[model samples]
Target: NRALYRAKFDAVTARLSATLDTVTPPAGFYLWPKTPVSDTVFARGLLEKTNVAVLPGSYLGREVDGINPGANHVRLALVATLEETLEAADRIADFMAQCYSA
Candidate 1:
């Protein structure tokens, strides 16, 4: 299970790196990728277009002085199977490519 998870995580991270910046956490089930737009907007569009749901990073953190550190990111949970995670990453890359290509 650990090897499976690491392979899935690495594949997804590589796929998403084409468009969104991702940090390789020392250990975690979630990927925090920086979005090109507002995190909420990005999350909504991703769900609507690709049928992939992610938590807007803003929802995971508290606002400090009207600034949410996670406002420009989204949290992608790689808890699915390897195939599913890869598919999600492809969809995300395609969606973001189209978004910024325009």
Candidate 2:
């Protein structure tokens, strides 16, 4: 499990390096990256465009003082097989390039 997590983590972080602010936790099976758009919008668009599902970070947080800490983030799970994880990362990278590239 650790090996799988490391591989998926490296692949995803490298793939998204140019497009998102990927937050690396000390140890986990998830990656929470700041999205260029609304987390809900990004998650929906990613699913619609790439068939890759992600949890909108907003779904994991509550609004505090009129600000949602996760309003602009998305959570990516690294629980798939290595091949699927790689494919998802590629699709996400491509999606980011198409929709959020500068």
Candidate 3:
């Protein structure tokens, strides 16, 4: 059972890594990371606004509540087409810029 799990994990990881390598974010933003994780409000917002999806860091057990888990970052799946990903990146960059400016 473990062997099967490992095999599937390895195959998915390898394919995901290879996919991430070829992706390019807009001009300012970048991929969160090449890992399997969960989605967050911020990530969800991006998906809703730009039709691009991302996993939030909290979803990866980084910012769990009621249990201090230290610093945990999220991994994003940038498996969308170049155009869609770029659009999403642009939207995210703009949103972040506005948030910081405020």
lDDT tens digits by residue: candidate 3, 1-102: 444434433443344343232233333223444322223555665567656565555554534457524222334444445455445445655544543233
- List candidate 3 stretches off by more than 4 Å: 1-30, 33-41, 44-51, 62-74
Instruction: Give, for candidate 3, the lowest lDDT window spanning 10 residues.
Output: 21-30
Q: Tell me the tens digit of each residue's lDDT in model 2 across 1-102.
A: 787788788888988888889866779999999988899999999999999999999999999999988899998999989899889999999998898888
Sliding window of 10 residues with minimal summed lDDT for model 2:
17-26
How accurate locally is residue 76 in candidate 2, as Cα lDDT from 0 to 100? Answer: 96
In model 1, which regions exceed 4 Å deviation? none
Write down the lDDT that model 3 would get. Answer: 0.44
lDDT of 1 by residue, 1-102 (tens): 777778877898888787888877878788899888899999999999999999999999899999999899999999988888899999999998887755
Best by TM-score: 2
Backbone steric clashes in candidate 1, count:
0
Candidate 2 at residue 15, lDDT?
Answer: 88
Q: lDDT of each structure?
A: 0.88, 0.90, 0.44
Q: Report the backbone clash tally of model 3.
A: 0
Models 1 onward score TM values of 0.94, 0.94, 0.42
